[model samples]
Target chain A: MRFPRWLLSDRTGLVLLAVLMIIGIGVPALNLLVPPDHPLHLTAYTVTLLGKYLCYALLAVSIDLVWGYMGILSLGHAAFFTLGGYCFGMYMMRQIGTRGVYGDPVLPDFMVFLNWKDLPWYWHSFDMFWFAALMVMVVPGLLAFIFGWFAFRSRVSGVYLSIITQALTYALMLAFFRNEMGFGGNNGLTDFKDILGYSIHADETRIVLFVLSALALAGGYLACRWLVSTRMGRVLVAIRDSEDRTRFLGYRVEQVKTLVFTFSAMLAGVAGALYVPQVGIINPGEFAPLNSIEAVIWVAVGGRGTLVGAVVGAVLVNYSKSWLTAALPEVWLFALGGLFVAVTLLLPYGLIGLLRRRRETAS
Target chain B: MSELIFEPEAAGMHTPVAPVDATHGILLYLEGVTVSFDGFKAIDNLSLYIGDGELRCIIGPNGAGKTTMMDIITGKTKPDAGRVFFGQTIDLLKLDEPAIARIGIGRKFQKPTVIEPLTVLENLELAMSGAKRLRGLMTTRMSGEERDRISAVLDQVGLNEQAQRLAGVLAHGQKQWLEIGMLLMQEPRLLLVDEPVAGMTPAEMERTAELLKSLAGNHSVVVVEHDMGFVRSIADQVTVLHQGRVLAEGRLDELQVDPLVIEVYLGGEDAHH
Candidate 1:
C-alpha cells in the first residue's frame, strides 16, 4: 500500500522548477554578455517571448487552482485577465500626458483626437500605481465572487457552469469593444513611459519585469499549495469527487467552491496586470474566449492536478507557438489545435502524466 | 482487556459513556414529520420516538420512506411539516446540516463514502476536524491524543491493520468499516446508518452486526435496512414501514406475527391497508 516516495512528494516538482528558473534567468544574462554587434543578440528576443510565456504560466496555475482542485472549469477567466490588463493599461495611458503625440497634458492623444472633453468617471484613479495594482486583483475577484455566489449557490455545476462562464466572457468582450466605452475604443491603451519612476524601455527594466514575473509565478504556486494543504483543501477535493457526500459530511460545498473560484480569478488578474506593461499594450483582443480556452489547454497539457505541470505546460506550449509562428505562420493554429487533440486522445494525463507513469514502471 | 471493556470511558474520550441506571427515555421525538418531492409525500406524517441508547432498526420495502426519515433527522432534507426534538432541548428543524452534525448527530449513507484518495488515517483525522467552515481546523494537525483516539475507533471498526492504506483500494466491506470508523471518530451520540449490510459478505455482515451491538450500551443507533436477518441479529426493536406510514412497531418476533406486517411484506391485494 506504500506509494513511492517521489510519487506524492513535491521534491521532483521543486527540482524541475529550479532547472527551469536557471534557464529562464541564465539565458537572458548569457545573451546580454555576448558582444552587441555579434549575431547572438538575436537571442534576446527569446527573453521577451519567454517572459510572456511566464505570465501565461501564472495564468495557467491560476486556472488549475479552480478547475483542477475545485472542479470549476471557468471559461470566463480571460475576462478577469483582460480586466486587470485594462486597469494597468489605464495607468500606463495616464503616464503619457503631454508626452503623447497630440501634446495634450490632461487627455490622452486618442481622446484628444477623438474630441472627448472630460475623462470618464471610472478613469479617475489610474494616476496611482497602487490603485491600479489593487484594481487588478480586486475587480476580477469581485466579479468571480458575485458570479460564483449565484451559480454555485443555485447548485449549477459541471457543463452548465462551463457554458455560463463562456457566455460571461463573450458579454464582456462585446462591452469592451464599444467606441463609447471610453477605453480607447478598439485600439485600446498604449504609449507608456514609466512605471514607478523606472524607464520601462531600458534593459534593466526588462530584467526587473522578468524577475517580477518569476516571483509572481513562485508566490502564486506557494499560495495555492498552502490552500490545498489544509483541511479545507481536503474538503474541496472531496467536493470535486462527490459533492453530495461532502454535503452529508457537513461541508458547505457552495461556499468552498466560490471562495476558490474568486481566489483563482484574482490570480489570473495579477497575471494579466503584469503582462500588459511588459508587452506594452492592452487591447480588446485580450477578452477573446479563445484565450481562456487556451489557458485550459495549458493546464490539460501539463497535467491538470499537478501545480508545476501548469507552469511547464504554459511555457512549453507558448515556446512552440513562437517557434511555429516564426517558421510557419499559417500552420501555427493548426498545430496548436492538433496538439490539443493529440494530447486529449492519446494522453489524457498530459506530459507529466507520462513522466509519472514511466518513472513508476522503471522503479 | 476485560477491565478496559468494562470501563466504557476507556473506549475514548469522545465515545458516549452514560451511566447504566437511568430513565433512558425517548431522546429523539420525530412527530408528524412530512416531506414531499414534487407532489408525492416521501415521508407521510411519520412519527417515531427513540429512547436513549436504543438500537432501533427501521425496516421497509422500497419507497417506504426510510431514507427520507433519516434525511429529515440529519438535516439533509427539510420536512414540509413536522417537529423533531433532540433530548427535549434542541429543535433540529431550525439547524442546517453542519449545525445539526455539530450537535452530535452523524449520518452514514447506503454507499461507503470515505475520502478514497486519502489514507484511512486521514479520513479519521478529517472526521475530527469539526465543521468545514471552521477556519482554524486545518492549521492544527491532529495531536497525538487525537491520533490515539482515531486508532481506538479504527480498532473498534476492525480497520487498525489497514490504517495507512488508500481508502480507494480497500475491500467493499472494509470501506464500510472505514466509514463507520469515520463516524466513530466523530464520537456522535446518535448514529443514523442506512443499509449497513447491503452488498456485504456474510462474514462482514456478522462483524458489522457485532460492531453495532457492542456500540449499543454507550451509543444510540438507528439503522434503516432491508435485510430482515441482519435486523433480527442486532436490532433491539424494529419498526416496519409501508408506504410513508408505520405499519407495525415492536420486537422482530412480535412484528413477524402481526398480520399487517406480513401483508406489507408480501404485497397483498389488501396493500392499501
Candidate 2:
C-alpha cells in the first residue's frame, strides 16, 4: 500500500517516527549486542530511564490532547496513571503465585500479612495478564468517563475544572494509601518476580520492556495525530477558542469534551502501566497531585497545542529531572517552578513554537 | 442538497437527510418567552413571529431583549416559560442548542465568532452541511464538491483570495463576513444574526445590508441591529423592542411615526445622558 500522505507529509509525524525508530531498534540493539566493558554499551540504567521517559511522553501527549487542543487542563491525570500502574501491579503481585515468600498460591503477601481470610472479590480476574492489561485502560477510562460526564455536563471549565482534577488525584492518593483498600498501601505493591513466566529482572526482559514502551509511545502519538487531523479535532479546536460559540453551531460541547477527556485518561493509563513494568514498582505516591502538575509543566515547556512538543517536553524535562536530582538536587524544584513561570510569561506556545519561528525565519 | 457544498457527486461523501419540517405560514414562532438573571428579566413576556422567508429586522435600544429573544428561538436560552416552535412540528423549548441547529436553525454571535486557528476554508468546512456528526467526520474526506462550496462561500463573502489565510488574521469586517459565510455553509432554514454590522465601516455595512437582504428568500433571516440607517436600508418588516417586550411592529417608515416606539427611543437616549 502507498504511504498515507498525512504520515509522510507531516514533518512532526515524520520526526516522531524517526525518533521512535532509533529508540525502538537502536537501544534494544545496544543493550543486547554491546559488551559490558564497552563505553558505548547502553547501560540497563539508561534503557530503563529512556523507557520511563517514553511512558511520561505518552502521558504528556494525552494531557496535551485535552489541555492544549480542547482547553481542558487536567491536573489530576496522575490519578489515572497511578490507577493503571496499580492494575498492572496487581497482576505482577498475582504472578508470584507459589513463589511468594508466604508460599500462598492465591493470596498476595499483603493480604496474608494483614490476616485477610480469602482473596478480595475485586481481585478475582486480576491474576490473568490480559485481564490486568484490560484494566489498565478500563479503570482509568471509566473513572474519567464518570467524572467528565458530571463535570462537563454541568459546564465546569477553566481553573475550577483544573482544581477539581487536582482534588481528585489527591483524594485517590489518600485512598490508595489506606492499608485496608486491598491494594498494597503506603509501601504499595513491589517485590515483583515473573511476568508472563519470564524473570522480571532478566536483562533480555528489560530490553523487551524498553522496546515495548517505545512502541506504545509511537502508537499513542499516531492515534493522537489521526484524532487531531479529523473533523472532530476541528470541533475540539473550535471549542477551545470559543466554547459557547461551538455549542450554538450545533456541536454538543459536553459530548466532545467527554470523548476527548476519557480517551486521554485511557492513554495516560496505558502509559502508567508501561511505566510500572519498566520501573519495577507501583505505589500510592504515584497518585500525588504534584506528579500530575509536573506532567502539565512538561507539556507547557514543550508547547501546549503541538503534539510533537508534548513528546519532546516530556522526554527533555524528565531527562533534566534525572540529571538535576543527581547533580544539584537542592535546586531541582526551584528550577522547574521557574521554568513554568518563564514559559507562561514568555514562550506562551512552549519550545516548539520557538522552533517553528526560527525555521520560518530561516526559510 | 445542502451537502452539495462538498463532492456529493464525486467523493461519495454521505449526504445528510435534512429533516424538512412543514411550516404553517410561520417560519418561526415565539409566544410569552421570558428569561431572568438574578430577578432582572432580560426577556419579559416577549411574543414574536416571522413568516416564511421573511427578512425581519429587530431594532431596540440597549437592554431591549433583542439578543435574548434570538437566544430563545435558537435554544441558547431557555425561557422561564414560553412556546418556541420551528416550522410547525419541532418544539425548540425541548431541544438543546445543538439539536436546534441540527433542525436547521443557525445563529451568528454579536461578536464575530470564527474558528481562528483553522484556515477560512476549514472554518466553513466544519459548519458545512455534512460531517456534522462524529462518525461521519471520522471517516470523511474532503471531496471536490466540498471545495467548490467553500470557494462559493468565500466568493460570496469577498474572501475568495484569502481562503488560505487563517481566520484569526482576518480584518475585523472580514471576520464578521467569514462568520456569515460559515453560517451560510449550513444552508439553514432560519438564520439569527446579531449585530452583523457592529464593527464594520460604513461601506462594509452597506455590503452587509446587501448580503443580508439577498439571503432573505432562501432563508428566513432575523437580524438584530442598533443601526437605524442599516435597518432602513434592508428591512422588509421591523420589530422594535423596549424593556424585553414588543414596543411596535411595522415597516421602518411606519414605526418611525409610532408614538410608543418614539417614546421608548427618546427615553433610552434621555437615560444615556
Candidate 3:
C-alpha cells in the first residue's frame, strides 16, 4: 500500500506510532501472560491507568487539530468529552437491567432515586450499544456544529471565542448537575455491570479496553495526520495565520471553522467514551472548565501545531499529574501553573519545538 | 503562458463567475458612495467608474478615503448610499467578501498578508480559485494542470526558486510578490492592489511596476499607490482622491500641473522631485 509521502516523512509521527504499537502489545502481554509475581507484571490497575492516559492522549490530539492547526483555542473540549462519556455511560447504565439496588430493568439507579417513572426522550436509543457508540461522537459533533455555525459566522475569534467555549462547557456542567436533566445529576453515570455481554470487572475486559484505547489513539492520530496533510489542512494553516487573507482568497472562513471544530469535537467525544469505560464512571465534573484548560496546557506543553507533540504532551503531563497528585497533592495545582508559566516564558514553542530547535542547531 | 485561460466549465467545476457585462466598457461602477464611522464621513458622495481592463491609480494623503473606496468595492465596508456594480449587471453591494472574490474581484491589502507558515507553493495553492468548498478541499489533490498553473504564477511573480520555502522566511519585497502571486492564482478579472510598492527598494519597485504593467491588458488593475514615481511609471490615468471625493482625474503629469491637485496633494511633494 502506498502511504502518503508527507505521512512517511513525518519522523515524530512515525516514532509515536511505533511507541504506541510496542505499548499496545507489550502492556497486555505483561499483564495477562506474565505471572503476578514477576517484576515486569503490569497490574490491571496500571493497565486501567494507562488506558485512561491513552484516552487523554486522544483528547489532546483532537484539541491540537483545532487549536494547533486551525487556530481555534477551544476551552470547552471537556464538554464534548463529557457528552461522549454520558452517551456511552447511558448504555452502560442500561446494561445494569435489574442488577441495580432498585432492581428496575428500564430505569437507572439515579432515575429510580429521583422518583422518575420513565427514561428521558433523549435517553431512548442509548440502550443499544451501537446507538450509544454512535451518540458518543454524534452528540458532541452536533453541539459543536451548531455552536460553531453561529460563532464562526459572527466572526467571534481569539480570546472572545475562547471565553465563549469556556462558557459553553460551564453551562453544560451546571445543566448536567440538575437531577431533572436525566444524566444522574452531580454524580453523573455509574454502576455498570457489563458491556456487550462481557463482565466489566474482568481482567480480560480491562486489557481489551486498554488495547482499544491504544487503537483509538492511533486511529485518531492517523485521521488527524491525514486531515492536516490535505489541501484543507493548508487552508486551515492559512486561516490560522491570516483569516482575512484566507477570506479574500474566496474561502468561506466560517464554514471551514465550523467543519473542523465539529470534527475536533467528535474526536474529543470518542476519547471521552473510552475514558468513561476505563475510569468506571462519567460525571458532570468532567465538564469543569479547568478540565478543558488542563487539556489545552497538555497541548501547549507538548507543542502546539504538532500532532505528535499533543500525544507526547498529554501523556507526559498526565503522567506527572498522576505522580504529583499522588505524591505531593497540595503542590500539583501550583506545579501545573508554574509549568505553564515556565513554558510560556522560556519554552514558547513547547517540548517538541525545543527538540526541533536543538536538532536544527546541531545539524 | 498558453494555460492562462481560466475555464471553470471546461474542468467540469462550478467556480462562481460574476456575469460581468463590460459591454459598455465600464467594469466597476461606484456611484454616490457614502460611508461614516461614528458620524464622521470617511467617504462622502464619492462616485467613480473603472473602465474594463484599465490601469487606474488612486492617490491621496492619509484619510483621503482611498482605502475606504477599495473597501466599498470589495464588500468589506458597506456604503450608506451607493450603487456599486460589477459590469452593468451584477450589483457588487449585494455580495459578501468571499462572494465578491469568487466573482472575480481580488483585493490585496496594504500589508503583504501571505500565509507565513505555509510554503510559497502551498500559499498559492490555498489561493487557487476553485476547490474551495468543504468537500472539494478535503479530497482534491493538485492535478498536473493545476501544478502547471502554479508554476506559471511562480515564474510570473519571480518566486519559482523559493516555491518550497516557507513564506515567513521571504524578504519584504518577495512577500509582496507572493501576495500578488496569490491573487493571480484566483484568475480575478479585476485586481484591487493597495500600496503595491510600499517599503521596497528602488529595484523592487521597478520590478513591481513591470509586473503590474504586464497584468493590465488581461486583468483590470486598480493600484492605490503612495509613491508618485511608482504611480507615474505604471498608471495610464490617475484619480486624485481628497476628503472622501475625487479631487481630479487625468494623467499623472496633468494632475501634477493642476492647481487644485497641487494645492491639496502634489504642491509640497513635487518640490522634492
Candidate 4:
C-alpha cells in the first residue's frame, strides 16, 4: 500500500513521527535508567501522568479525524472512551480472581457485595485478556455505528447531532451509576491488581504502557493522515463543505459519515483501554459531559482539522490543566474558557495554524 | 444567407447513452408531478417531456416552478403524486437524488456549490465519472487518462488558466463555468442546468451559450434560464412554465408571439421591449 509513503511525504506528518519517537524513547530512559534521587529523574507518577497524556493525545486525534475533516462535532465521544475503559476494567476485575476483598474466584468484590451467586453472563470471557481487548474496540465501535445509523439516516445533522450525542453520553452516565447496572456504580471498577499476570505497580510496566501509548498516538495519526489523503478523504471534505452537492454528485454521504464515525470511536476505545492500565481506575466520572466538552477545547486549541494540531492542543491544554489545578485549583475551568475564547478570536486555526502563518510570513 | 437545419443523423455521432432509448426517442417523461411546501403548491400538476439528445430551454418568472420541476425529475423533491421515467425503462420517481445522479442524470444548482477548499482540478476530479462507491475510491487512484480528461474539460470551460486555484476564490463567472465543467464530468444523458448565466458578464454569457449549444447533440440538455437571449440562441424548442404548469411548448418564435404567453409573462405594453 502507498499509505506509508503517502504519510511520510508530508512535513507535518514527518514532524509528528519524530516528536513521538523522541518522547517514546526519552521518557522511558529517564524513568528507568536514570538514578531515582537525581534532580532530572522521571518519577513513576510522572510516567503515569505522561502516559495518560499520550492517551489523551490519541483521543484528541480521533476527534480531529471526524470533527476537523468531516465537520462532525461529536459531543459524546467520552462515552466511547469510558466504555472502552469499562471493558478492560471488567477484565481487570476478572483477573483479581479470589484475591479481591471478598476472595471469590467467580466474582469481583462488587458482585460479591451485591450478593450474586455466579458471575453475570455478560461478564463471561472477560477473564481472557484477548477477548477483553477485542471488546474494548468492538463495544464502542458498535454503539457508534448504531447511533450514526439512526442519526445520519434520519438526516439529523449539525447542532442537533451534537445535542443528541450529549444526551446519549449523559444517559449512559446515569445508567452506569446505578447499583443495579452490575458495574461498580459510583466507584467504578478499580484497584486492578495485574494485567496478563504482570505487576501493574512495576515501573517497567509503566514504561511499557507509556511507550505503547506513544505508539498508539503515532499510529492513529498515520491512519488519519492516510485516510484524508485518499480519494475517500476528498469525498469526506466535499461532504463537509457542501453535503447536498456531494449527494447530488452520487456519493452516499450517510455511509461515508457512519464509516468515519465508527472508526473514530474505535480509536478512542483503544486510547481509553491504554488509559485504564496507567491510571489504575475506571469510573463513571469519565462519562461526565464536561469531559467531552473539554476534549473539543483541546482540538480547538491545537487546531481542529489538522491531526498533529489536535495532539499538540491536547498536551498543551491538559498540561495547563494539571498545573493550574495544582496552583490555583479553582481557576482551571475559567482558564480553559479563556483560552478557548482567545484561540477563537486571535488564532482561529490553533497553534499549528499559527506556526504555519509565521512560516509563511518568514519565507 | 441560407438557413441551416441540424440533421438528426449528425446529432447521434457523439451521443452518450448508457443504453440507447431507441424505442421511445424520449429521454425524460413526467406526468402530473405535484409538490407543495407548507400548503403553497410550488409545482401543481406539472407534466413535461424531453426528447433524446435534445437541447430544451425552460423559461419562467420567479416562483413559476422551473427549479421545482427540475427538482422533481432529479429526485431532490418527491412529488405527492407523479410519474417520472427516464429512457422509458428507469422509474426516476422511485430513486433518490444520488441514485438518480448515478444513473446518468446530473443537475447544476442555481448557486455554484463547489467544494471551496479543494482546488479547481480537485473539484473536477471528484465529479469525474468512475466508481463512486467508498470501496472503489479507497482502492483506486486516478489513471493517466483521467488526468487528461480533467485537462480537456478545463480547457473546454476556458478554466485551464485557473485550474490550480481554489474553487472558493473563482470569480462569479468562473465558478459558474467550473460548475458546468463539473456536470460535464459525469457525461450524464440528461443535464439539468438552473440559471446558468444568472450572474455572468455578457462575454461569459456568450461563451456559456456556445458551451450549452455544443453539448446538445451528444447529451440532452435542459436549461432553466431567465436570460431570453441565451435561451433563444441555444434552445431548439422552448417550454414556457407558469403557475406550476406548462404554459406553452414550441419553437422560440412560436412562444414569443403567443397571445396568452404575452398576457401572463411578456407584457402587452412592453411587447417590443
Candidate 5:
C-alpha cells in the first residue's frame, strides 16, 4: 500500500487528516459509550454542532478549489449549497407521509397548505432516497455548468465575474422565497423526521451523521489534493496567473474553467446535503449572498490556494462565530468585518502563509 | 524491441503531429489584412508572406503596426478585411488563438510571460504539445521520453540548473529564454517572437542571437525587434514596416542603403553607418 508523494508531502494535510480521524472516533465514543452523568460524555447537541461545522468546512474547501486555484472568485456558491439542501429536504418531506398535522399521505403539508392537490412534476421522484441523493449533486453541477459555459466563454472574469456570482446567489434567494416556486416558500423545508428509516433525532443517528461529515471532508480534501498534484493543476495555476498566456499555449481555457467550476459546485452540493440533515432544516435563507461571502472569508483567513487552510479557517472562524454570537450577539457581524479588513491589510496571504513564512525565516 | 514496447508514444501516442503544409514554400500568408481602432487605420492593406524555415526580422517605429501584424496572424485580433491563411488550405481567420497554436503557430509576447509561481520545468510542461483536452490533461502522466525532451529544452535554453527553481526568481534574460523554451515545447512550425532582445545585456543579447539563430531552419522564426545591431547579426532578410505596410524587403545591408528605407525608417541619420 504505497501512498503517492502528494499525500505524504503535504504536512498540513496529514495533520488535518489525523485530527479529523481522532475527532471522528473520539466524538462517537464519548457520545455513545459514556453515560450522560459522566464528565467525559459528549452530548448529542455538541455532536450535531460539530457535524454542522464539518459541513461548512467541506463547503469552504469547495470554494477554495475554484477561488484559490482556478482564480474564479465565486460569491454565489451558497446557491449550489442551498440547492443541494432543497433536494435532500424534498426527500425528507416525502418521508413525512401522513405524519404531518394535515395527515396527507401523498401531499406534503406545504402543498396542502397552498391548496395544491398533487405533488409538482419536479418533486415526483424525490420520494426515493437514491434519486434525491443523485439530484443533490446533479442540480447544482448542472446549474454551474450552464452558468459557467456562458460566462467563461464570453471571457467575463476578475471582478466582473465575482459580481455576477454574487448576483446569481442573490437572485436564487429571491426566487426561492416565493411560494409559487414550490420549494416551501419563505420558511423553506423543515420538520424532517427520518433519514433512511433511522430516526434523525436519535443519538446514534446524530453520531453517524457526524462521522459521515468527517469522512466526506477527508475524502473531499484528498480528491482536491490529488487534483492539484496533477498536470491539470499546473494548468489551473497557469490560468490563474495569466489567462492569456495559458490561451496562447494552446490550452482550452474556458473548458478547463467550466469543468473545474462544475466539479467545485458538486462538492458544495454534497456539503449542503449533509448540512440539512444535521441542522434539521433547509431554508431560502441558506441562499443568502452573505453565506457565500462568509465562506470566501474563511478561505482568505485560513489561506487561499491551500486546501488544509480552508478546513482550518472554516472550523476556527465558525467556532469563534458560535462563541461571539452567543456572548455579544450584535457585535458578531462587526467582528467578522473587522477580521476580514485586518486580514486584507495585514496578512495578504492569510494566517497559514504567515506561519509558513515564520518557519522558513527561523530555519 | 522490448524497450520500444514500453514506450508511451508507441502505445497510442498523445503528442500532436504538426499539420502545417509548407511544401509550397510559403508557411504563412497574410493578404490585404486591415484592422482599425477608432477612425485611424492601425493596419491598412498589409500584405506579408513568411517563407518556410525563414528567419525574417521586422523593424518599425512606434505605432507602425508591428505588434498588430503578429496579433492578426495569431488570431488575437481579427482583421476587419482580408485573408489570413496557414499553409494553402487552412484559413487562419476561421480559427481562434488556441486553435491557431494547436495547428503549429506559437507567439511570444513583448514582455516575459512565464507562470512565475510554477517551477521552470512545470512551466515548460504546461506549454508542451498534446493533452490540451480535459481528459488527457487530468489523467496522463509525463512519460520518460517526455522528461528527456524537457531536459533537452532546459539545456537548449541554458536553464538546466534552474529547472527546479520558480520562474519568478529568474533574471530578465533567463525569463526571456524560459519563454522561448515554453514556445519550443509546443514544437511549433512558425514562431512569432516579439522584441526578443529588448532590455537584455550585451552578452545576453549575443546569446539570444545565437539561440534564435539555432532555432532557424528547424522552426520558421519571425523576430520583431527594435535593436538594429541585433537584427543585422541574426537577420538574413529584413522587412521594414512603416504605417501598417511593408516599406522595404531585402537584406539588412541593402535596406540600410535604400533611400526609401533610410528616409522612412533609418531617419537618414543612422543610414550612413
Candidate 6:
C-alpha cells in the first residue's frame, strides 16, 4: 500500500527553489554591505538588475499560468503591468507635486505648465497609497476577467487568442500615448518624491524595495507552485493539453481559464506596482507588444511549464540585456530577437528543461 | 449450472445499485437525437435505450455516427434535436459536458485521455473529487477513506504495482486501464467507452473485456467499438448503427445474422465482411 515518493517527487523543483532563495536574499544583503563610494559597486548594480529581474519574473510567472496551464498566451500582459505601474506612478507624481519646478500642489508640473485648472478625477486617490495599490491589482484583474470571459466563451484559442491579446495591448498603448488621456501623455509618470514618507534617493529605501521585490518573487513563485500542485492545477494542465477532454471530464474549462487568467494578470499588476517605485518611471512604451513578447521570451528561456524556470529566465535575460546594452548597445535588439528565436526553436524547456531532461536520461 | 446462476441481484454480491428501474430497466433514453455538421448528418434521428446494469455494444462503420452518438450522450456535442434522459429524470440535453459528468455520467475517449503529466495517483485523485480551485484543493489532502477507495480502484484496474508511475510513461494498455480507473473513481452510474481495445494487444484486450464484464452487475456500460471479438466477449446487448441511424437492435447472436447489419458492415456490396 505504500508508494515510493521518489518517482513522484519534482526533483528539479527543490534545486530551483534553493537557488531562488539564495538570489532573493543574497543579492540585496550584498548590496547593503557595499559602501556608497566603492569603485566596485558591483553589488549595487546587481541589486538593481536583480530587482528588475524579479519584476520581470513576476510578469513571466503570470504569463506561465495562462500560457502553460490554461492554454492562454496573452501577448498583452505588459499592458496590464504598465497600467498598474502608471497607477502607482500617479501617486508618486502627486507626492512630488509641490517639489516640482512649478511647485503647484493642486496640479502636477506638466498640468500647471500646460495651464490646466485641476487634477483629474482618476488622480484624486493618488495621495492614498492603499487606493493606488488597490487600483494596481483590481484594474488589471477586472480587465483580464472581462476580456477572458468574452474571448474564451466564444471558443478562441491558439494563434487567434494571441492576436486578440496583442490587439488589446496595442489599443491601450495607443490610448495611453495621447496627452488628453491625462496619464502625463507620452512622457508618462516619473519624478517621484517618496513612497510612505521615505526619500526615494536613500539607499536604505532602495534596498527595502529590493527586498520587497525579492519577497514578491518568492511569494509569487510559492503561490504559482501551490496553484499548479492542486486539483485545479491538474485541471489547468488538462485544459492546456486537451481542453475538450478536460471539459468532458466535468470541468467548466472557460471559467477555469478565466479565473487563472485574471489571477495571473493581478500578479502582473503587483509586479508593475513594485516595479514603478524602484525603476522610477511608467510609460506607454511599457504597454508595447514587444515588452510582452520579451516576458514570453523570459518564460520560454527559463522553462514555460515550470515556475522557477520563469524566475531564472527573467533574471538571466535581463542581466544579459544590461550587459549587452552596456557592451554592444546597438546590436542588443538583434541579440534579443535571436534569443527568442533560439529559445523557441532550440531550448524548448529552456535552462530548467535541459537540466530536467539531463537528469531523466542519466537516471 | 443451477447453483451458478448469473442473476444481477445475487445475495453474495457486494455491488450497490442506486435504484432498480422496473419500467423497462431503462438507464438512458435518446429520443429523436439529430446532429449535423455543415449539412452533413452525423447522427440523424437516432433513438436508442440502454437498460440499467447492461453492457451494450454499438457497432458501426467509420462514418456511421457511433462517436457522435457517444458525444451527444456525454455532452461533448449538442444535438440539433433530441431528448436525452439519464435514468428517465435528468435532462441531459439541458446540461453541458461537465454538468453531465457531475450528474454521474462518465466518458472515455478512444485516445485514452488520462492526464499524462500527473502521476497515476494524482490523475485518479482529480477524477474522484470535484474541487477546481487551488486554494481549497491544496488546503484539503485526500483522506484515508479516499486513499483506500483509490487503492481499491488501482487494484481493480491492475495498476496497483505502478501507482506512483507517471501516467505519461505507462504503456498504451495501462494508460487505457488508468483512464478506466479514473472513470471508476467518479462512481458514475453509466460509463461510455469508445474503442477500449483499439490499439491494445490481444492479451490486453482480453484483460479489458474481463475488467468491463466484471463491472456489468453494478454499473451500466455502453461501449462503442469496432472490434467484434472484443464486443462478443463483453456485450449483453448489441446495437448496430448505419448511416446516422440504428440498423438493428438485439442480442449479439441475433444481430450477427440480420441482413441490414451484414449489409452495413460489408458496405452494402457483400452481405458479409
lDDT of model 3 at position B188: 90
- Scanning candidate 2 chain A in windows of ten residues, the lowest lDDT window is A1-10
Please estimate how well model 2 matches the true structure, expressed as its whole-model Cα lDDT.
Answer: 0.86
Per-residue lDDT for A1-363 in model 3, tens only? 997787888899999999999999999999999999999999999999999999999999999999999999999999999899989999999999999999998999988888998888987887799999999998899899889988998999999999999999999999999988888898888878889999888999999999999999999999999899889899899899899998888877877788789889999999999999889999889999999999999999999999898999999999999999999999999999999899888887799999999999999
Residues B1-273, model 4: lDDT tens digits: 001101212211122235635367888998888899999999888899898889999987778898889888888889998898998788888878777887788889999889899999989998877646444466336788988999999998999999999999999989988988888887688899998998889998999999988888888999998777878888879998888989999998888789888887776443332
A198-289, model 5: which lDDT tens digit per residue? 99999999999999999999999999988998898998999999999998998778777887898899999999999999999999999998
What digit string (tens of lDDT, one per residue) describes model 2 on residues B20-123?
Answer: 56557788888888899899999888889898889999888888888788778877788998898887877889887877776788899999999999999889
Quote the chain B TM-score of every prediction: 0.87, 0.89, 0.92, 0.88, 0.91, 0.87
Residue-by-residue lDDT tens digits, candidate 3, B36-90 = 9999999999998999999999988788999989888988899899899999899
Q: Residue B151 deviation, candidate 3, in Å?
A: 1.0
lDDT of candidates 1 onward, in order:
0.80, 0.86, 0.90, 0.87, 0.90, 0.81
Output the worst ten-in-a-row residue range by lDDT, candidate 6 chain B: B5-14
Tell me which residue pairs clash in candidate 5: none
- Give the range where candidate 6 chain A is weakest over 10 consecutive residues by summed lDDT: A2-11
TM-score of 6: 0.91
Best by TM-score: 3
Show the lowest summed lDDT stretch of 10 residues, model 1 chain B.
B11-20
Sort by DockQ, best first.
Answer: 3, 5, 2, 4, 6, 1
In CAPRI terms, model 1 is classed as: incorrect
Best by DockQ: 3
Fraction of real interface contacts that model 4 preserves: 0.58
Query: Which model is ahead, 3 or 4, in terms of lDDT?
Result: 3
DockQ of each: 0.23, 0.42, 0.47, 0.32, 0.43, 0.27
For model 5, the superposed segments whose C-alpha errors exceed 4 Å read B1-18, B268-273
Task: Give the per-residue Cα lDDT of candidate 6 at A61.
Answer: 88
